[model samples]
Target: MWHTVVGAVGLVMGLLPHVLHHIGLLAGTAFVAGSGGTALFGALGLLASVPMLIRLYRRFGSWVAPAVGLLVFAAMFSLSAFVIGPAISGAEGDVTTPSPAPAVDHTDHPGH
Candidate 1:
């Protein structure tokens, strides 16, 4: 029960920043990316832990509950790193406008 609740909370925490970003209320793209990463890991952690918890309760009674929790947190301890993939920085630096050509020196030209 505790593990499920914690997982759910983590998922919600991850989703909030994204929701704000999607609605245009938030600025920085990095934040959105971070939040997305958090959500993925949290949700996955929750999913992976539930079955473990159930199995622990059935077999080890109270002895294995802590272990199950540790496993769940351990799984979550890094989805932000491996599972989320590399961090995405903001837009690349590329000029939108072309530079103007140098003006011809017609005034000094004999032909002019």
Candidate 2:
């Protein structure tokens, strides 16, 4: 059923980062490197869950329960990917590497 499928997807979305990391497919807190498949899937699930929720809403003529669960999952997913994960892995702020040192001016010193 759509409800079951959507619920499962929401669960996965909520745990995407930890799951991917645990499975060894991703290494960093930032978005998945290169293809970004896990992030992509989580994003897609967030988008797709809407219509499924609507369908469930129409079918049951009620909205609160399913909406709350899905919304919570989506929020958790977004927060984890965009905030918590980065903070946990120390990737939240910009990383500044010192610029290469300027070439020595030994010419002026003349090998002194």
Candidate 3:
């Protein structure tokens, strides 16, 4: 019973981000645009998976532990992409690229 609930929660939690991204509310391109509430939603979705992770740990023991870690990492990445991606995109103009250095005229140097 609880397992089913956990599974349902996990499924919904995992799918919500994809749905938002597909709908264009979440950041799919720019990072900062989705860095607001959408990022929070994604983080909440990951936190909601803790119960399912516990269930998995009990069922599969140590073997599935790594998988759980990977899931957490994936969740963090998704949230970061949605949140940071747009902010970075918006800040692209603030980043200054290095200009090419001018050639020195060595012919006028005493050591030349």
Candidate 4:
């Protein structure tokens, strides 16, 4: 039971950086927005969850537990990227109305 809880916590921690980035929280950070900072943070989350994964593996004596972990990670990633992120960033309402385009000047100016 505790192993399941730990795994869930680890998944959330692991995906936090991505979620923050999606919500525009990491926009101003050069490292997090540009380089591989998000990936680094994600890897760290996975590393932190290593103990939980190990425990699951030992308890189940099979690879199924680890595979389930991977599936959960993927599901959470998708959920944040597609649903939660867009909703939080207001991207979902982007299609509601389009802004009017700026008028262009057709007059031609001659320079000597």
Q: What is the C-alpha lDDT profile of model 1 across 47-75, one tens digit per residue? A: 65666677777777785685768775766
lDDT of 2: 0.68
What tens digits encode model 3's per-residue C-alpha lDDT throughout 13-109?
7676556556554354343233465567656855775665676788778746858666777877775665575575565433578999998888987
How far residue 102's Cα lies from its native spot in candidate 3, in Å, is: 28
Q: Rank the candidates by TM-score, best first.
A: 4, 2, 3, 1
lDDT of 2 by residue, 36-71 (tens): 754686767668677767777887788786788697
Clashing pairs in 4: none
lDDT for 87 (candidate 3): 72
What's each prediction's clash count? 0, 0, 6, 0
TM-scores for candidates 1 onward, in order? 0.33, 0.40, 0.37, 0.50
Best by the TM-score measure? 4
